[model samples]
Target: MKYDFIVVGHGLAGAILAETLRSRGSKVLVIDEPKENSASRVAAGLLNPVAGKRFAKSWLADAFIPAANAFYEALEARYGQQLFFHKPIYKIFSSIEEQNTWMAKSAGDNWGDYILATHTQSINQPGIDDPFGGIMIGRGGFLHVYALLDLLTEDLLKQELYLPERFDMDELQLTESGVKYKSIAADQLIFCEGYQVVHNPYFKWLPIQPTKGEVLEVQAEQNFSPECIYNKAVYVVPEGAGRFIIGATYDWRNPDEEPTPQGQEELSERFRQITSKQFKVTGHWAGIRPAVRDRRPLAGTHPKYKQLSVFNGMGSKGVLMAPYLAQRFAAALAGEEEVMPEIHIFRYLSLYYAYTDQQNQQP
Candidate 1:
């Protein structure tokens, strides 16, 4: 078998990359071993334009947001399934100072565009504690992560472009002209293995800090608005019916996917702080996010092996970052453009060279 590219992993990054490549008329094959704990499977699919405690606009919101919306919308239309839901995110102000800060920012130029309107009343109904009021944000919502992955996988299977198997590095042979992995030959091999890249001998030197996060699905007695996301100490987004998705707890020390008692208690405490309503915890999920020290995605071909490339490290922002970044990567692969300087794999060449020099000298 031969292809223009062999993409490892079927997560959002890999799926979007494969789709983009195929749209450009390239032959692509995707190899993935399904994992019960892959981050994409466990993601809440939150795409917020303004995030974090300071409520700063997300990095490159202008570009990433529209690209993401268009990408997800296209996927939804092709598959005849509802995947992306455009909803407003109502952020509960934690303090009077925070409320004042939003007021000032809302008066600013770009911030005003993102700021739909401010409310002085509690939008949480009876269960939520929003005495300081909340602000509704625009151009942000959630993606049905698992549904999108499943639909994409089905399409690849029908096209005979997907292989449900693990890619073994031992079976791979890097030739002068291209790469050979088992029976398949390709001009280039791109790895989008997410946090599992730690095991890839060829690209393991890339610093990928995998953090474990946990989220819960619960049925609360109160009716939260399904059209908007309620946030404060913890987020409770209505997931149809009487169920709401409450997430998420971040832990750097542990990478295990099993829900922890500590994580549950912490989330419960935060949920309580945000809402006074009682809820029944029905489900819990955990997965590792592929974060980086510098907080930028890693893309582009290897310094030593031009035929090998990587596109990973979107971390918690995978929903917002994947589409646009994948398009850029696909363009670079087609030789139509170059990867951005900031997220380019060349940013870590110094470390790669240092590691190579040390290894050669030791042997």
Candidate 2:
């Protein structure tokens, strides 16, 4: 079989990349191991404009927010499935100082349209604490990640564009014009394997700090508002009916995606602090995020193997970053544009050189 591009891993990065390339009239074949636990699978799909304890605007929120919104909206229309939710994020202010800081920032045009409002009605309900009030961040919400992936999977399968198998690097042959995996040929091979990129020899020199995250699915005693994503020490987003997703715990040392008792307890305690509502823990999930050292996405083609490229390391912000970056990467592959410098693999060229030099020096 021959193709314009052979994409490995059907996770968020790979899915978006393949779709983008296909939209541009390229022949694409996706290779993936179907049951693998991936960050995208377990992600809450939150696309917040502001994050962290400091409540500062997220990186490139202005660019990412609009791009993601439009991209997901188009996909929803194309797929005929409701995927994107334009819910506001109500960030509960922990202190008067925090409130003051938000007041000052909201007064400026720094965040532009992303900041919907400085304050909202307190979530006046029992077991929920919010005396300090909260801020409403607009144009952000969750993407029904798995729903989109499954829709894409079905479409690809029907089109005979998907190969549901694990990709083995050993069987791959780098050819003069492209690459050959087994009997399949392609103009280029793009790796979007997420954290599994650690095992890929070609681009492992890039610093990818994979972090483990755990989240819980709980059935709250009361049905929370479906309009906004409420956050305090933990986030309790309405997942329809009486269920809410309470998560997530981040751990750098752990590599495996197996949920831990400690992770559950931590999330449970945090969930309790935010809301006094009784709930039953229905499900627990964990996955590794493909984080990078500089906290930016790692993209672009390989240094030596020009026909090989990567589109990984969007990390926890994959929902926000993937659409825009994938479009850029697909354009770069089509010889229409250049991958941005900061996220491009060239940023780590020195590391690749150092690694090759060390390899050549070895006996």
Best by TM-score: 1
List the global CA lDDT of all models.
0.86, 0.85
lDDT of 2 by residue, 1-363 (tens): 899999999989899889889989999999999964578988888888787776678887777877898888888898788898878887888778888887776666477666777654455755666777788777778888889899899999999999999898899999998999999999999999888888899988989987998989998776445668888777777789888887788798988989999999999998876776788999999989888999899889898898899999988788898888888888888888889887998999899999899889999
| Residue pair clashes in candidate 1 | none
- Candidate 2's C-alpha runs over 4 A off are 120-126
Q: Could you tell me every candidate's TM-score relative to the true structure? A: 0.96, 0.95
Cα error, candidate 2, residue 146 (Å)? 0.6
Error of 1 at 263 (Å): 0.9
Q: How far off is residue 41 in model 2, in Å?
A: 0.8
Q: Name the top lDDT candidate.
A: 1
What C-alpha lDDT, on a 0 to 100 scale, does residue 336 get in candidate 2? 87
CA RMSD of each candidate after superposition: 1.5, 1.7
